[model samples]
Target: MSERTDPRVVVLTVLLQLAQEARQADTLDAFAFVAANSLKRLVPFRNAALWTDRPARSGVSAVSGVAEIDPDSPAMIWLDALCRHLAEDTSTTGPMGVRPENIPPELEPQWTEWGGPFALWLPLRHPSRQVVLGGVWIIRDTAFNGAELALLERLGEALGETLSRHLRIGTTRSAILAALTRRRLAIAAAIFLLALFPVRLSVTAPAEIAARDPMVLAAPRDGVVARFFVQPNQMVKAGDKLFELDDVDVRNRHELAIRDLAIARTDHKRANQAAFADPQSSAELSILANRIERAQAEEIYSRELLARSEVVAEKNGLVIFTDPADWLGKPVKTGERIALLSDPEKVEVLAWLASTDAIVLRSGAAVRMFLNTAPLSPLKASLESASYEAQMSPAGVLSYRLKASLAEDEPPPRIGLHGSARVYADNVPLIAWILRKPLATLRQLVGL
Candidate 1:
């Protein structure tokens, strides 16, 4: 017989052609159509359906000779259930004939109505994983013979490999579309622009209102403080008594000086009276006169000490000091600060910038002071000076001393009012401004 007339040659040619069509199909939907309708060329089937394990698409994807699939339809629903039941049989890996007697009792009733006298189940498996990806269901009026089942088994592998490839490509394409959506792209652009935007480089430090060029009042001598003549923040005039030291010792010294001076004068008078009569007495008069002069000097010095026991203000201004009780009976050394005489209107901001937060600043960089008492009313100032080297602050931190002059138009806050200062330097990119501290810490840790 001629090759064209040979039945075996015809079957082999159709199988090869179907396999090529499956591989050449551009999409999963197209391949599903081919799998459901085109398989009849090798084995005749009255109806055919395709099913998959994908959760979002777990149902009959296509039906023989139907361009569109209505999943809600009774036939489609029943077919989906039947395919799922058949796919669970792990023991039947090859093409097998299915009949009512072979299926569970629950599916027997539906088989009589929806299925034909014989059905063929072909499971699609992943080429490498050997896991079931899905299956194809075919029903016909005639029973499938052993030769037909064997031919279908080979075709099942080709279909399974093609279906698996399409599923993987679909998943990758879905992921790419999801990640490149317009909303996500817009958000990324916004963040990138924000990082590049310019902002004034700034830092916050501890600050307070301080007197400008105020006169400091310290202890005049080494003594215990007896009393304070003026209260803290009280306005005072020049020569007003500010405070006093213990004067008991000074008063006693003055009294003794006076007594010694009196004795010296008496001795000098006696020597002068005797000097008029004898030469020896004349020599004694010179020595006695010198003694009188020395005694007079001592008396004058003691009187001055007594007068200075009470300290007075040198200028007319406000007296700024701590609680009066703190200084009462408190011992002080010479030149130790006791109080400050400051003008109420003249004030400046004193900020302690930590060494870690220090930045390059000019003479007139902007500074804003937010007081603890009145934070809403921030006082504006311009940097006047910064210490050349860092020093230990009262809070036990090494920091640079910064002095900023308050704006002329703004009223100065009360002296000694504590606050925070925000100092602004040259403009820089927002990203650099935000990462400045973290980058500095990283550099310190890595030594790079």
Candidate 2:
């Protein structure tokens, strides 16, 4: 039995050729190429083309037997339109045969113009579903017999499976498209929310509560803290003794000035009485008067120093020191700090925004704080001020100081309480909010 005469031999040969090409194909384009050049031998055609309608792509992939239909030719456009019309209905679950006679009357003129004067289309669909994958257009004069159609019908299933197997996109695009389209209302709602809704563009930072009126008492003059009148955090009233300076030295000086003034005044009075009796005594009286004036000035200064010996609270508040022992016997310079007189009720949040994340924070921006002690019960506040310069935070991270005022009605956070805060800033789109950071990072790295 000759190969040409034997239908079984021809079919087997064509199958082997197609299998080899199928194995070599890596993409949808390559698969389409293999189908175009190889399938014609079994179902002979004068002109043939393969097309697909996958995501992000649509049009002809491969052509065979016709060199006349070039890219710039009008025939390509007509062919595309013709195939698109046929592929509109994806219910063609499997490969289906069609002849020139089956071509709809509305499409006949176009079919004659581009695809072919006489042709057949084998519409291929997803192997497992009703969705149309693509089709093969073959131009031939002879009609397909039962044996030829049978051969193609038996093999079309495998061909569709091969197309599916080789396709990189697969059903993922369709699935996503279906999800987006089926829940169109949800998509519209999301778009609407993104466009109209004003979300907070917040910057998170480490924070703590600080007293608004923190009165720090500094040493009036050089002295050692001789004694502490109260313990740490002890509540005190105005004029209450807070601590005492080592005033023994100051007292001695005060006594010396007082004794010196008394002696100078006594001497000056004697000189004045003598001035009336002797001319030399008048010169002595002038010298004594000068000495008496110097003594009085000295006396006044010494008394002022002695008065400052006892440190007192000028305003009402708790002593804001951790340990009284820290101040005991410690020698301090003039104007050296001692302790803070802080009203626990008068407090504000001091947040440190990282240098990298800091933005132009306006006054009265929204602020939400969460203390380490009470993470769940968030306290609300508003931005009061932001530092013009960056500084190192307590943790050593470079940050900008941001001030905020907690709502008065909300329980005032304890003075010196540590926490974290989110400072709300300028508005941005929802997509921008999600992607801006990543895009910014990418631009920095890639310099795009």
Tens digit of per-residue lDDT, candidate 1, span 1-448: 6645888888899999999999999988999988999998888999998898774678887889999989998878878887888888867778877888877787778887888888888998766433677899998988888889888988998998898788773455445656678668899999999999999999899999999999989988778899999889999999899999998988999999999999999998988888878889889888888988989999999898788788898889999999999989998898999999999999999999999899998999999999999899898999999999999987999999999999998887789899899999999999999999999999989999
User: TM-score of predicted model 2?
Assistant: 0.58
Clashing pairs in model 2, backbone N/Cα/C closer than 3 A = none
Candidate 2 structure lDDT: 0.78
TM-scores for the candidates: 0.64, 0.58
* Top candidate, metric lDDT: 1
Task: Kindly list the per-residue Cα lDDT of model 2 for residues 1-448, writing each as its tens digit.
Answer: 7645786886888877776677678776667767787787677778778877766667776788543345455666667767887788566543455644565676666655554545666676665554566777777677667777666655565666677665643577468656778799788987878776666688789999887868998888988999988887788999999988999999999999999999999998888888888888888987888898999999999999989888899988978876778888999988988888988778899999988786778999999999999999989999999889899998999989889998977898778788899888898767766776788778779988
lDDT of 1: 0.88
